[model samples]
Target: MAMDADLVTAGVLVIGDEILSGRTKDKNVGFIADYLTQLGIDLKEVRIVADDTDAIVEAVNAMRACWTYLFTTGGIGPTHDDITADSVATAFGVRIDHDPRAVDILTRHYQAGELNEARMRMARVPFGADLIENKVSSAPGFRLENVHVMAGVPSVMQAMMDAIAPTLRTNSALLSETIDTGVGEGLVAEPLRIAQERHPEVVMGSYPYLRDGLFATKLVLRSREQDKLKAACEDIETMLADLKGQRQAQI
Candidate 1:
């Protein structure tokens, strides 16, 4: 599908058997989402897959083609299960080998005896990929075209994101406003619907919560345009005030 030219979009792929098995709880997805949102890149989708090669390859190919950037976390470590580098190389039909730059980084970080074969696995990068510096650990992540492969460790992944953020393309930040309607969603559904119809440019959602043992709704409106969001918010407030007045008269 053709993406909107005005918006920068992204997809996240979380790869690891441990995450799927619930052994490791995910912390990177939320962090990445908030990070992208702040940079005006809409995170359109997120998928979690195991260490399996086919699944990784498929997800990498699909997400990279559809979004402006695809960020994958996990499976880049120095173990048998760390197959992300190979899978991504296969997906892009590129050769995989130990990158001299990555090897040098790992070499400098580790002592002479510590840079074993297993540790060297971290240096295997897809051809023509630029290394993403990991400030926490020297085992660098890589950027191949639009795909960014980073370590699953939260701190390292966050550091990698910081390293890449400055190089990314961004759009206008998404703006949002919320209103506490002080009534149940059922009571204000029609008015909210009318408001949405009147302002088709704004996206609206109703979140119902319990307040003082009674149901109350929080209506959220989001838009890229500031003026449109403000206008829609004002309209909703006016409509809600009229509804409140009618309810008071009935009581």
Candidate 2:
């Protein structure tokens, strides 16, 4: 789907073989959604790619080019397979090396002589990139242009998000209202379609659910313009009420 040009849109590139293999349960996507919703940034797309360098580079390049911002998670660690920083560097055509700022932070955290080669790998970052401080762990993430490289661990990723949030361009919050319609999709299908076509700016949807053994349909209306959303909601309620009265009279 096409993104709304009026909104600040973001894409998530999840890079890790473990996540695709179902070995690791990813917790970052939900965290990011809630975080972005609060900041008024629309998350338009999400992709999961393996730890392969080529795949990571291609996904990063596409997402960074298309979206206002791209947040990447996983593969930034001390292991041989941790290649996100270097792959992102390849995508941006920049030199990758051990950044001293990151080194100093990790150095201070590790005990004397405890910062081995594996641990030191965390210091590697792309040229011209700025460090994203990790309050959960001393190791840092990096920001290169529109892409923000973060940790795979949920806590560390959250810390990185908090660090870079204030720097991002945000939009006004998307407003939403949910009203229960004591009917099913069959009863409101035509009206819902008409409402959606009439108000293209609003996101109108019906969700079916069971409450205390009784089924009902919930009308969820969303829009950045509060007045427009309210009007669409009122129209839907009136349509449903008219249908109810007609049914009672026919019975």
What C-alpha lDDT values do all the predictions have?
0.95, 0.92
Candidate 2 lDDT:
0.92
Q: After superposition, how far is residue 182 of candidate 2 from its true place, in Å?
A: 2.0
What TM-scores do the predictions have? 0.96, 0.95
Query: Pairs clashing in candidate 1?
Result: none
Worst 10 residues of 2 by lDDT: 1-10
lDDT of 2 by residue, 143-222 (tens): 99999999999999999999999999999988999988888778878989988887888988899988888777998888
Number of backbone collisions per candidate: 0, 0
TM-score for candidate 1, please give it. 0.96
Error of 1 at 30 (Å): 0.9
* TM-score of model number 2: 0.95
Model 1 score (lDDT): 0.95
Candidate 1: list runs displaced more than 4 Å: 1-3
